[model samples]
Target: MTHHAYADRRSGSRTHADGRPPAPPPLPVAARRGPAGRRLLTGLFLVGLVASVLPWWLDTPAGSLTDATATTTAAGQITGLLAGYLLLVQVLMMSRLPVLERVVGGERIAAWHRDLGVTLLVAVLAHTAFILVGYGGLTGRSPWDQAGVMLREYQDLVSAFAAAGLLVLVGLTSVRAVRRALPYELWHATHLAGYAVLLLGFAHQFSNGTQLFRPGPVRTGWIVCYGLVVAALVWGRLVGPLTVNLRHRLRVADVVAESPDTVSIYLTGVRLDRLALLGGQFFRWRFLTRGCWWQSHPFSVSAAANGRWLRLTVKVVGAYTGDLRDLEPGVRVWAVGPSGTFTAAHRVRDRALLIAGGSGITPLRAMLEELPPGAALIYRARTPADVLLHRELDWLAQARGVRIWYVVGSRNDPGPRQVMSPDGLRRLVPDVARRDVYLCGPPGLVEQSRRLLRRIGVPRRQIHVGTFEL
Candidate 1:
């Protein structure tokens, strides 16, 4: 394939020496709504929390805490309420809602989901403990015996216990080490049980909850909350994607090998002008082929949307990705996004510094087409042969007035170590602190670069990060 085939296509009418279009103008800063969206979401969550606990506060009188059993029961009620609310929060965060993804960004939502997962597990466990102990004290029996009695007598209690076990298993699998040890598909499939946990735990909340047992506004409100979360999940996960795929009718146009381990899949669809995509955004792609039809994976566009085609550069790191290399033209693709906030619209500064390791350059390569002039890119790879799209990057540098540095070496090599050091970064970029630093790569490289950037006086807020992790 010719180099021009991979060049930026967002250039409207302007043509360059190489016959490719010129880079487009940067997006306006006002286009980004992250800070305002974050505040709005936070306020809404706090309000919901207050509402969730209000019935408990009203029902329990001050004199009700006269005994150890009463106090324990009260604690159990509060913990159960919090856990229910938090479970909703966790699901909403990952629902892939367009508004949330556009305003708050997918990366931030994923981070929140990970942190809250831990808290949700703790709250659920605490609620179970408090209930067993409180009931045991009241019945003059051991907690274990009380658990058995409750399980035998209470309606939906068996399902609740099953939900608790499933939740615990999900939590254990989510641990970084465990998650890493498992295959991506297995880990992702395991996480799907979280929805089952919600379903199993639902009936118990209304059947047994002290504050929810009787029909009232409190119960109605909780039901409404559940309905809203379920609606969001359906729309975000199902309806929205179906609509986009049906409208676009995306099909694989071609697949070209960029390196021994990497290939770029070219996609074409109908009415591309209406796709409304930006550089650095990604889609969860599901190719409609026998072996690949069921699995959907997220991949960023390696080149800016040019109204006629979209490109995704992928490295074959696992079986799923390895399958992508063999996809033929004309195969239909179901895509779920055009998501992520790693675009020029989200930049905090006029000039940007992009640090890419391995295949992480894909999004950065696309972003260069929209960033304002004078942006700099540092591409890191273990060897020269490992670099992907060097020609395209070189062409972009001259066309967009970007400065390019290809850093090649082992992680322990002195040259790479110094170049990544605080002093080395300052010397190369000179005004690194004044620019927005966009980092993407392996976990270790991204973390190390972030530390060095901070040490060189770059504020944490100025650093934007992208990762392959879901």
Candidate 2:
């Protein structure tokens, strides 16, 4: 339907006849609690940092750093320790545990994973550089010759070198520019090489490192840290999905084209209610189809789950999504999520203002159906043709007393019609600042809207942002 048609349909919605929405719904009790997990995670990071350096400090003799060789060795040990700790942390951040995702949000976790990965690469490089220099200085040999000697003499030095090279490759591909240049499948596959790097690096550390080789509290602590990290990875990433897929046996029930480039896939499985997904949450779904089984793409639930049914609307953005339009019924599926914190559980106010861009409406559409009345949705699209699920929005407007505003105009229009700007936002939703805002979209739009929301007097704590970026 055209934007004008949708406008006319919603003209008589009359959710409230006073030219104002009703009083906002009261915020849920769970929403008022502060982010306890964030604080706890930060504390753990600090503790880990201290633990990482404590061994080197305790073992070093007084005035050890007075000698250049000792100083270089000490610095190398510090970098190695930090790199090892951070490598484990990178795994933990992406363990995909529901409790962690609920507490810290998936976006924050993914971002932390990327940041820590970059830092880990730098530390590993520094560790190599320092170790080469220190050993070369002590042995009166050139750095290049010392490197060959160490690799030939050390137990796991070859594996360590291989791990470092793999780490560098993964890190380079993860760069924003490099990632965008590659296909999602290629990038994702490249990213998974981190697990291999971790394995090789771990062997190198235990076999050659003096700190970990010593039987003491430091070694015990390293063992415990690695053990927990391995357990988390196994359960959260591997066994968790395997168990869920076996129990649920999710399969495609139907597929309906929602727009020229968008298709809504209906999934059904045994005991789907057990999944317990929130309204605006998403899953990394892998469809067991010939052309689509290799990679799982994250898509928000387009509608609330009803016992055995779940729906996700996907836009044709890349090869994976483009192939989804042709997906048939009865395809087996495996999912690894319900991850994110954009649901009503995170709301901080009674009134909610949901801002969506393009296909970002999927999750918000689900939220509109499940959220209490006194919520308003502002959907921004580049043109009338880009607006999706208008009929459903209007139906909700009439049935559930929720206001729906479809801002259909060219985003690139240089004039006054860019509804995403601060001025346009204020004009569209005069009471926006009073409502808790939930935003989901591309990175650029989400960041820009966040800034606009902040500038318009919306407190940072009251605005929740979700992104589609991996």
Candidate 3:
């Protein structure tokens, strides 16, 4: 249908003469757990940092830093401690732990992991450099010579160096330019080396560190930290998925094309009514097809959980997603989650404005079923042919009292620009500043919409963004 047709239809229906719907219901009681959860996690992180440095602070006398060599050595020890602690924290962030996913959300966790990764790399490199320089100064040898001596004489030093090398490799690939150049599978495989890096560096800490070389409370505490991290990894990464898959026993029920490039995969399983899921959450799906069994990819449910089946709409952008178009009925599927916080439960206001670009409409479409009446959607696509599920969106608009606008044009076109601008948005939804805005799209569109929304006086906390860029 043409854009004008949609606007005319809306005007004749539930909308008033001015083409605007009635005011949205008052803001609901917002979820209060998120702030408390953040505070608790922050406090625990601070406590961990203090505990990491406590051994050094207690063992070293006030006059111990009497010389440059002594200070450098101390710095190396401290950095080592911090690096080890942070590595554990980083692993936990991506471990798929339900508590972290629930409290912090996947998008924020991914952001924290990425920003902290740079700090971890710097700490590791600094520890290596400081130790070499400090030891060399004390022994009247070059730093290079000291490095060679440590590698030859110290236990696990070889593995530590290897771990450092692997870390450097991971960091290099994680650069935006390099990561985009690499295939998803290749990047994912390389990223898993983080676990190996942790394992390889483990013995060096207890075997050679000044504070942990001998048995003590500090050493025991460090060991417990390792144990806890291991437990979290085992449960979140392995046991949790295993339990979900065994219980659901999901299989591909059907696959239907939504557009030339998009297909919806319907999944049926045992006892689906018992599966606890939110509308906008996603899963890491591993199809047990011969060629696709080894890798899993994250996709959001394209429809709300309806107790009978689940659906995931995917755009065939790569080899893996393209392969999904050929998936046959009854193929077994292994899925990892009901993860993310893009659902109504996380909203800070009763009314919401969802802005979607291209395939980013997938999650927002599912969320429309669950949000209260009188929400609005602005879907931006380059062409009319690129718009997916407009017929369903139209039905949803009437059934749920939603106001949807299909903004189709090139980014530089005046129509799209004017509709997405701060003034234009306010004209369409005058109470936009009082509603939660859910923004999902390509990175560029999301960034631009975010800037426009902020300019129109939407509070940052009310602007919830959905991203799957872990």
The prediction achieving the highest lDDT against the true structure is 1
Judging by TM-score against the true structure, name the best candidate: 1
Encode model 1's per-residue lDDT on 159-270: one tens digit a residue: 9999999999999999999999998889899999999988999999999999999999989989999999999999999999889988999998778777888888888899
Report the C-alpha displacement of residue 135, candidate 2, in angstroms: 1.8
For all predicted structures, in order, the TM-scores are: 0.94, 0.90, 0.92
lDDT of 3 by residue, 1-470 (tens): 00112221222232222445532222323344446787799899989987888888887999989999999999999999999999999888888998888788777888888888999999999999999999999999899999999999986999999999999999999998999999988998999999999899999998988998889888998999999998999999999999999999999877777777888787889898798777778888999999999999999987777676888889999899999999998999999888888877788888999999999998998888778888999999998978987766877788789999999999899989999888889989999999999998888899999999999899998998888587
Worst 10 residues of 1 by lDDT: 8-17
Provide C-alpha RMSD values for all models, in order. 2.7, 5.3, 5.8
Model 2 TM-score (2 dp): 0.90
Error of 3 at 179 (Å): 0.7
Distance (Å) between predicted and true CA of 130, model 3? Answer: 0.8
Candidate 3, superposed: residue stretches over 4 Å from native: 1-33
Ranking by lDDT: 1, 3, 2
- lDDT (0 to 1) per candidate: 0.87, 0.80, 0.85
